[model samples]
Target chain A: MPRATSRATLFEVAAQADVSVSTVSKVLNGRAGVSDETRARIEALLQDHRYQQRSGKRQAAPLLDVLCYEVDSPFGSEVLASIEQSARLQRIGMVLSGATEQATPYAHWVDDVLRRQPVGVVLIACKLSADDRQRLRSRNIPLVMVDPAGTPAPDVPSIGSADWNGGYQATRHLIDLGHTRIGIITGPADMMASTARLSGYRAALDSAGLTGEPELVRPGRFHHADGLEQGRALLSLPDPPTAIFASSDLYALGVYEAARTLGLSIPADLSVVGYDDLSIARWAGPPLTTVHVPLVAMAEQAVHLVMRLNDEPEMAFSRIDIDTTLVVRGSTAARNISK
Target chain B: MPRATSRATLFEVAAQADVSVSTVSKVLNGRAGVSDETRARIEALLQDHRYQQRSGKRQAAPLLDVLCYEVDSPFGSEVLASIEQSARLQRIGMVLSGATEQATPYAHWVDDVLRRQPVGVVLIACKLSADDRQRLRSRNIPLVMVDPAGTPAPDVPSIGSADWNGGYQATRHLIDLGHTRIGIITGPADMMASTARLSGYRAALDSAGLTGEPELVRPGRFHHADGLEQGRALLSLPDPPTAIFASSDLYALGVYEAARTLGLSIPADLSVVGYDDLSIARWAGPPLTTVHVPLVAMAEQAVHLVMRLNDEPEMAFSRIDIDTTLVVRGSTAARNISK
Candidate 1:
């Protein structure tokens, strides 16, 4: 593997690639007129040699690159807005891009990022391939992740909310309301955050001396559709849950729709709790009782960490999980025995 | 006033400001070490002499500046996400910033823009001061607005949805459903879009030969609180209208909350129609019947127009309003006669 301390000069790289210095410069600056094959070869050679461009020569404004999995999702947008505000406060330009459906950026995204030469990159609910990581590393660009989609690489620092505690608190709130038969809609199984939340839910039930029912735990992908489908199924069971802990705010809305479709009203007929106290939580018909993820704090931490890494590249890899708190609202209520 | 055709050299600006060329260069590049007083004086001279920096000297990555009001608002985020996508497709970076509460950018936002030297600037539901406009103009940076707040400057191109037609279509939908007594919740009085929507609502009532009641008209700032406040006020009347047209989707959610608080159910007790069919509309309990604003298309147009203006700086000021359509969902129904 190429080392950061050893970097090849532009002239040396051009000589090794058997290309003119201007041709190498064109690829380096993301200018047009370079053939794709030659560009690829030069990029591979640069990576092999670990060519690091001099930062002082970059004339662009200071920028922070942000790559989000779903830029329009309620959670994604809120996180993005927070980061944009923080970046603005620090006088850093934010360059935002949406990841592809696979929770990764498009093919040419890395090329573009190399061209922009942002001070650092922040990935929200997305992952980067090893090759992409090496490319960014070769350029000496720092990267930080917020709530990474999958298992975060050991070397990359990440920021996330305390999903286990949030899940435990949400479930505990429902349990305190005399809801023994409570259902839960879980996020994607592969995500550590989702699994942690689910484990917390089970722990809460076990600690309460109640036997958790496997049938009551339904799987979902943190989508509204999943909420609607799973919610309807849960409600259709012989012994339906009196309350539900939806793992996401979006899922809670779907549950609301499900209840509405089944002629049930929130809190009165079927109580619900949600995660992520996004603005939608307040706008829900009855207002949602939810776990508030400190998105703003997390965003600030992400930006701060990325900048810190840029300044101190040798800093050890660390994970910071901000605290999560449950916000009580109108959606949750005590069980109605008569029903 | 600085003319776009006339230009001044850095040396001339420095001479006029009684400073060395390097000091003037420091201010131009937004580098530190220049005193505020001196920087101000140099900026005045640069603007006075119509100093247009040579574009070729800029080595920064291509960027499109986006200034949005209420960056986290449902409407704003969606528009931002769209523009980000379009900019990425064009290999242009998007530098996003949230405007202050006053619908104007912070004091240093313009200075930052000048330093970035973006291809162009796009303002979303935000306005620029005359001085700010002049600064951008002196730099020969093109500006475009999307659903601009207040009155759009005559010289700036803007992209907007057909608010008037949308309002007409929404009100007409309720009318066609056999509702004669209809109430309307309008957006901020100052925004041209809001006024145009109100006019369309009035035109629809007039064409239907129904007497529009002054008591039925209420005001809002396109916020959920306004929706709830105005909705409750209208619904509390001794003889309240059976149907309501909320000018924005957020207002519709507030109206939903208000109705829930008043023991009223949507479509069954009262019919509600909302504008700007954002994702929240679908997530609403009964789902919202709303006017669909072509936000993606509008965003694309904003990017395309800004880029076009950059290339053709002398293009005439123009406004494009994409068509709006009424999407009938579960929120609206025939007026209940027994209520």
Candidate 2:
């Protein structure tokens, strides 16, 4: 961190805001975590003190940090690839860290980030705890989230896709094709996206005058193995669903495996739909029909947002969600099997 | 770098070797890019000076660096995830950097690596340029290659799977299935792995007393899109091969798309074989029969080697190759059509 100018150092702002010097610095730097009220107070103090260019010791050498819940997630690779490309274009250093799934929050992850003193951080499918959130804010570091795994905190800005609508459309597509017995596979039950998607599935079923069977809905991680296991369970049920809606492309791919294991042909015997049209989706057997999540666009925009947040601390932050569309490929077909 | 012992600094070693200060540093630090004669001379000087723990500013911070040419590759994700796990266990920091193919040799990548001063670097399917090799060695950093894209330099150590044998076995399997005309998709023509696999394919045909046609081979990247295009082309030929061997699991998935587009069923119409046996491979339609590349084990071993290199500068450097096996599932079948 650079020292402030002689006219009004950060100390004065801290004194005026009745906050710690670090809090005042964070406010000055436009880092996330500070409450709007506190930020406003700090802003007023800076103006009152005739804030000048408060710069010292800061360099452009700081790395850009990326925090992901599961770096191995199917959707993670594309998003990180895009973020990395953008970082390289600007010659910014980047460090990617994943939160361990252990009971405790990332063991020493925040401390490592603090030590690196990254210019800003981008989180994907990750939610921060109160302590780490506070630490990042007080440190005056900018943070942004991409497709946050759950509902973001009150103040954390994020970029996500219209997953609920995507789910609704995918379910409705299957319904429109004369499919009443539809099974749905979702992400971890706690994830807001998963719940919203589940709700959308229910809504579609209700609108179609079909009561979705509780036995048909399976919840698991956003991974292929989970998809395969859940899909097999669904397919093995007494009254198996004719169509399956997987919450993620990876999940849907697992459904493909389940269908294959049973010697069932896609579309002919079982219609399947996936979300997050990751590049691999189009290459899946029968070219997976999926809901397209603008992965690259979201990543690019998140980087842009964090950069802006780094430069203009005074700018207000909010959530931005891109609309998702159903991409009908070769994976869906009209119901051919009798109930 | 920290200053050396009272007997002599890196400058004295450079003067004695009639080489640049960086080369002498490389020799003493046990980094690659230094010649045998020069390294021997530098070692003799250190011994003559009675080098009493001629330590420099190296610290145990011990952050591991990982570089890959294609960050979005199917195999890249699993390898990195494993590397991250190993790194966390050792309480070491890991930084992953992707070499952008847009021309400039990893624009400013070396500068960023130097700034972090990583204890060691692991390159996956990426070969450093001469300039980068020199820079890393001069900085006294250890380097290891994982599944090197091409034949690694003599001095640099590497850990890779027996791709040639894997390719040979996959071809032999197809031949055993009574398929005389087997098409093959390889990675970039320049990559050593690509050529090696292609060689193995030819060897299999020779061993079977069958003629191998160059027209049946397609050389491209280890990517799905390339697989789709090449697979489509091969299948569209007048006398399409009864079975296809794709070099990467990702490439085989693309072939699945082509098969779908051409209305051909896996194992039933056009048998397929894949390599790398990535997690997605099992979920691929028909549970792709692939050459299992021990991705996780290779990454773990690479990290272990780099750590050892970091600790013992005088330890001999050598290449290690793990065995690859054909994991048969449901993707191959006996040829039913006349050749």
Candidate 3:
């Protein structure tokens, strides 16, 4: 199963595997009839030989595969909607899969994708294992990631929002509203987007000549419970900040709950700023003031990139970051010094 | 082309169209190379002859088609996630399409579906025209609806929650809190779910020996704006109800905003009840008391029904309604007499 330096034809692979070329073709095309044991042997041979199917020779219907983390999450759903719309405009069907809790597809997902033989794969805040990547490569399937989890491979292109700028804008909005002591709810530490956002928050605080207190910063996995727990802890402090910057809209909702639990009102008692202006941001009670991540543009870019890469697989991969902006809404207000 | 009284074979249709059997086969299988005019002519002849492809003979990849009104809507997203998971577990791909504003797919949607030749089609709160329905019927494709709009055709089985029960329970909860005057935000009139809920509300009032007030019943399209506008109107009445029953979670959020604008506190000033216990329900500032529509179960049922229909197309269509339950949370409480 050692990798071959040169490409091997289907006939050659079939000969090496001691199977008919049609059997090898069936395995390559993901058609049924080949036994599991034989299919696995042929698959390994195909991978080792680095067999590449000619472009435009796909037998399956035009489909774009999407692997997303938490498909029902606000962020995932909105991005999926954008991608679905883009794919529809191009008359391509979209096949969606939910990644595991670790942000990777389940063990059988790659197998399913291979069988489906989609034109391209789009991952939204999801990751693919090296073996899975090799499998797709052997099949000549193009993949593009949206807000990839962890450090993305240099060879793989990705689309993401300007997280640092978003974090800075959210913090600056609060600071501009006369908030010197601001609490923050940061996303998971491991995610680059989260780290960048935290860094931006720190930069904003440093530029404003405000001391960054460890107690004012809380870590989270971008879950509502994280926001609620950290928000409660922050608001319960002896000298609580007048404002809080929640890095995600879901987190902001959690902060809202925390405030309500403690009998505090938004803006008046604790001005709040959130990030990722998803539709729920507008549906929030106070119509959350937050940083708007350009998810629609990012989704469109990911789809377009997939198409481009499918056509020209040799093109150099590129990373794209759409701009982010602060949306002023009813959630943020001037810090009331009287409190 | 007039409908034929008897089923016709492919060879007979090819003979009538003056085309080779292989050419007719290409058109039936949605293969390329057939001219549009010729394809149309052949399709009409096939339809006139009521040509039906063998169910198991579909050559397209195993896929299920989904047509949703708004793929990004909280309800739609949740349902889609459930279906995707179900499809994944069954080793089938789901092809998603967003329906038009009218709750019907676009003109070319049926054509695209035919080309894809999915195992079956699932409509999430979407509709199909008679012509489109006939097209799917001609191809022997199964169709199932989840929470269908309008009166579902008796022949087309649909899966939905116990809307009447849901509405009754919501209104009953408010009545149990000793609030005799309760306002309701109703969904669109054309939707059976909305009418069922509205009827349930009336029944609950009748059972509680309370007269329903026309002024208190507000119409909405299950949108945030509808809730906000209707909530404002209800609250501005000379004598406002102490409790509001928002049929949708988005509407509940809008009502929350309306209450905020009017300087009223939830539960203390006015209790609110919402339907569809989406994830946002838990994240609501004062966690919303909502009717839990079993979206996961409904989705699973829709997917399973599609599969069943595909295997046994003659199986009698059965409409299933999963149960709904009320979830008590921070949003609703006993009516306050002090106000």
Candidate 4:
């Protein structure tokens, strides 16, 4: 088995061989049907790289399940990219399904997954329903939840950041930049991450002996439009916040939309803070100073956790909370001392 | 069958009933094991909406194959979300496969897909490799290509926008904004879209009676980093362009990154335009004025086309070009007139 940190991926082998990634999977799996010439070449490359079979046993090629709530958002796409990168490194094939992507019956969906026979599954930003959990458990499919939108079931292991800390960090960053009147745009109230982040934001405010004005705290979805809607409402106040903290990068971008619409320049007029520190954060015109949750690391660890659970069911159900940090970028500024 | 533009969605039903999307799917498909009480409630809701089955004859499902270069990028994810949305409304199933996401072999992979028995296939931003095409054909799986990255195989049905027109539109927008020395960042030199877009930019430059400088035209991948690199190069020229046109939104964001790094304010110090009018383009700090390629519509039409081909293989493979429209937003402005 390859080390978890192995950077060499199966996709590289395919690119090197001038063949499809699928061809490399066949050659690695010792599956019959590939022309001997192609198989031999792939084998040689595999041996050169010391790439061993996933295990000594003749198990089917590495296939895993990746489920997402939606596929379009930057957050979803970023996490998917990280997970896919990790899976590719292990030569693991992915069978992707979206909980809301289609209305395929749970029973039928399980039947399909059983046919594919993924070694493990990763569900992102959504909770696994009880019925589906029963079916997956019955099939002995190990699963890990990442950034689950709702709470994870008691027994399931989840890998994610401390949302409370992220919120606290985002708010503190704004406070440190000298903005006492800071507003927050949070995810839906039902989401654990959202409430936790809201708590963190409150915690930060309390620590500074400042009150979090209910009027400035707007709860919204982890989406751009929600950010926009809430941002407009927040900024339209009699005395709008000098700075705002958005719970997610997508939401932060929405806030930017509102800023543009309201003719409020970022930082110079309204310093903004965002979470997720996704690529968008770094590349935004005035790079968004935000909370950096380790999305890629969380995804990689989630995949690893699933694989481990698959091999060893004796493992304890656990929750691993990755730490969040502040990445000070260009989006926030001092309140009284404007640049 | 559901009308393509209908307001009713599976999510709505799931929301109305306050059940999981899977629950709604199970109830709708008449899959074994739905409880009597829950089924009755769901059925009542279904009847209320007059939602009919996708097909009169319930022969399993309308599963179709969706292929892409990779599933992680914004562009790929956007198109996918659109397809998935449409598939959900019509109760169609989608089996997504990415060319570089895993190392599954073409022949063996086909055997797996064949087992699932998808009605048709949608290949996006990737070629229908001859071998895979042959296998899919042998299995009688109809296929449609969308925004193929490479030169599409002749005789294959394809759907895309006129990249040339998009490029022309983007450049003309900059030109009309009084940018005489407008730079452009093209996609890979070998891609059809890249060439067409380049041609369109040239056409616009010719019409404006301003010669496009080779030094100002930079070709890069449809990625943010590429945009950043090319933008820097273009801006560093002794006679830098007053405006820059990026072929894709991701690339356009890269240009935004470079502008910030160089202390240039968008639409003020430097004007930038991008193609693909993806959601990110709108939420950008200074909303990018872009040529909107109808991504969701294209994907919906592609799914429809795939189904049509599956039903009638005798139908000639066709190329459909959706018109591109220019959305005037904040990114472009009259030159040297700071806002």
Where does candidate 1 stray beyond 4 Å?
A: A1-60, B1-15, B20-60
lDDT of each: 0.88, 0.79, 0.88, 0.75
TM-score of chain A of each: 0.91, 0.82, 0.91, 0.80
Among all windows of 10 consecutive residues in model 2 chain B, the one with the lowest summed lDDT is: B52-61
A236: Cα error in model 4, Å: 4.4
Q: Would you list the clashing residue pairs of candidate 2?
A: A2-A56, B2-B57
lDDT of 2 by residue, B1-339 (tens): 232455356667778778897776555444458776877677766555544333246553347778877676677777887888788777666777787563124765776676567878889888787656655665557889887765568788899889789889999999999999999998877677788899899999999998888889998778788889999999999989999999888888889889988988889899899998887787787788999988878988999998887777557887888899999988898998643
Q: Across residues A1-339, which tens digit of lDDT does each residue of candidate 3 receive?
A: 433433347878889899998998777666678898998798788876777776657543599999999999999999999999999898889999898988999866777777778889999898887767877877778989898887788888888889999889999889999999999999877688898899999999999999889999999998999999999999999999889999999999899889988989887899999899999889887889999998889989999999998888878877898999999999889989888
**What DockQ, on C-alphas, does every prediction get?**
0.68, 0.30, 0.67, 0.20
B52-80, model 3: which lDDT tens digit per residue?
Answer: 67686644358999999889998889999
- Show how many residue pairs clash in every candidate, following the order shown: 0, 2, 0, 3
Give one digit per residue, the lDDT tens place, for model 1 in B120-225.
9999999998878877876778899998987788988999999999989999999998889899999888788899999999999999999889999999889999
Per-residue lDDT of A196-287 in model 1, one digit per residue for the tens?
A: 89998999998899878999999998889989999999999999999999999999999999998998988899999999999999999889
Model 4 over residues B1-339: C-alpha lDDT tens digits?
332212355677678888877887665433445676886676566555645333223334346667676576778888887887676566565656656532223323454454455677788877755755655554456878888766678868999988889989899988888889999998877567788899999999999999988899898878788999999999999878889998888888999889877988788889898899988887787788899999988988898898787666658767898999999888889999542
Clashing pairs in 3: none
- Supply candidate 4's per-residue lDDT for A85: 65
Listed in order, each prediction's TM-score against the native is 0.94, 0.80, 0.93, 0.73
